[model samples]
Target: MKLDVTRRSREAMRAYLAEALDGCYEGEPTISPIEGGRAAAERQLSNFDVRRYASRNHVTRGHVSRMSPYIRHGVMTLREVRDAVFARFGRVGESIYKFVFELAWHQFWQEVYAGLGDEIYADIEDYKFPPPVWQETLPDDVARAETGLVCMDEALRELYATGYLHNHARMWFAAYLIHHRRVHWSVGERLFFAHLLDGNPPPNALSWQWVASTFSSKPYYFNRQNIEKYTDGTWCRQCTAACPFDQTYDALAGQLFGNA
Candidate 1:
């Protein structure tokens, strides 16, 4: 059998987002956002606005987040991507391992999240919820923040302009969104699914929980300055990668790197 994929580079994926799927969504999130968190682990919503991903750089929405949804929904399978890679790299050794690792990395996280306590769907139990809230009560301000409009960083603006974001940048983005902004990661998670083309529920949802300390907190806060040192002045001018907190940074970076 011959399998031909017209590859959509991260760049191409961004361009095709809203354009490819706009006619879906009849009402406002049939499943309310907060309550929806606990629904069926995840729901596969097909059809999205083509215009949503058509910004000169909308690939962030249409392409990147779309992958996991399709894979999760049975529209496509991980096996397909694997077969394509295996054909080129074959089995065994680091070369093949590297290729397989990326896909597996995605899978591993999904599993990790499924087992998290049901509370994983929301913020840490210990934290207090202030305002009376509901699944459907998503404020427009919160919507703007997750889209990277709340912050004034070039990395974030680019994230807004382009739908795609480097995985590394997402970590920083989530932490800042959850911590600095005082917004719940679950809120952030919902926005991600709404906008991301490659949004994988497991990785996307659980990762947000992890960052918010509902999961783990060895490096309590990812240092902002440390990231600047590592990136060497590239990416995230508005939000530096260096973690603001230190002790947690030392302990956490280890787990993060190991996991990554």
Candidate 2:
């Protein structure tokens, strides 16, 4: 159907979906800030910065390209993105290695999905540590962005509002849900899949597993100090909750996993 999407305003488009897909889709239809289509994708690609992405991707407010939605939707292909990087930055060396490696990691997940299919929905391996009985569903507080932790609450609000979350934020949120709150990794994976613009089953599931210690050699948890440093205390500065992550790793491990 050569439908002119431009004919309808964002509200009209959302209303159409709500009427057309009724039970299949719920909630208020908020548009993503990321634009769609080849033109937008190309523009974003043209502005790619390899060096800053490499150096700052670990931080919340990083220089990483927000190309995920375009790439995920096939408005741009992985090869196209990789070629764009090389076209601008020349052959991969120290500067572009981290960015290219990330692209490669994305491809690696795609390959794994192709090979394993639905098996990735289940735990790929056993947990590295004895795990507590985890909640089978995402908690109402976390889902509603009311989890008193400013970092997690803000991340959830962003995910709900934009269908996007910075990678570091995603990690922190997942760790908070899986380790701090003792929710199942699958619960978090499903929640992300439902909201993320770039949500792919392989990476989403496996990454959650990695955080939960079901696929990795160790569970990934972050302390208040790490969050404060990377986010430049953006969330911590205003947070008033009894900070659960405000402890050493050894303390967290012992408290979260000891005798579980």
TM per model? 0.51, 0.91
Q: lDDT by residue for model 2 over 39-104, one digit each (tens)?
A: 988888887787677546455667888888887888888888988889888885776877778888
Best model number under TM-score? 2
Q: Candidate 2, residue 151: CA error in Å?
A: 0.3
Model 1, span 57-161: residue lDDT tens: 222222222344346555556776566445544565654565456669777876666676455576543432122222443456444444443232444544445
lDDT of each: 0.50, 0.85
Off by over 4 Å in 1: 1-75, 109-120, 123-152, 217-220, 229-231, 235-260
lDDT comparing candidate 1 with the true structure: 0.50
Judge candidate 2 against the unseen true structure and give its global Cα lDDT, from 0 to 1.
0.85
Residue 87 CA displacement from its true place in model 2, Å:
0.7
Each prediction's number of clashing residue pairs = 35, 0
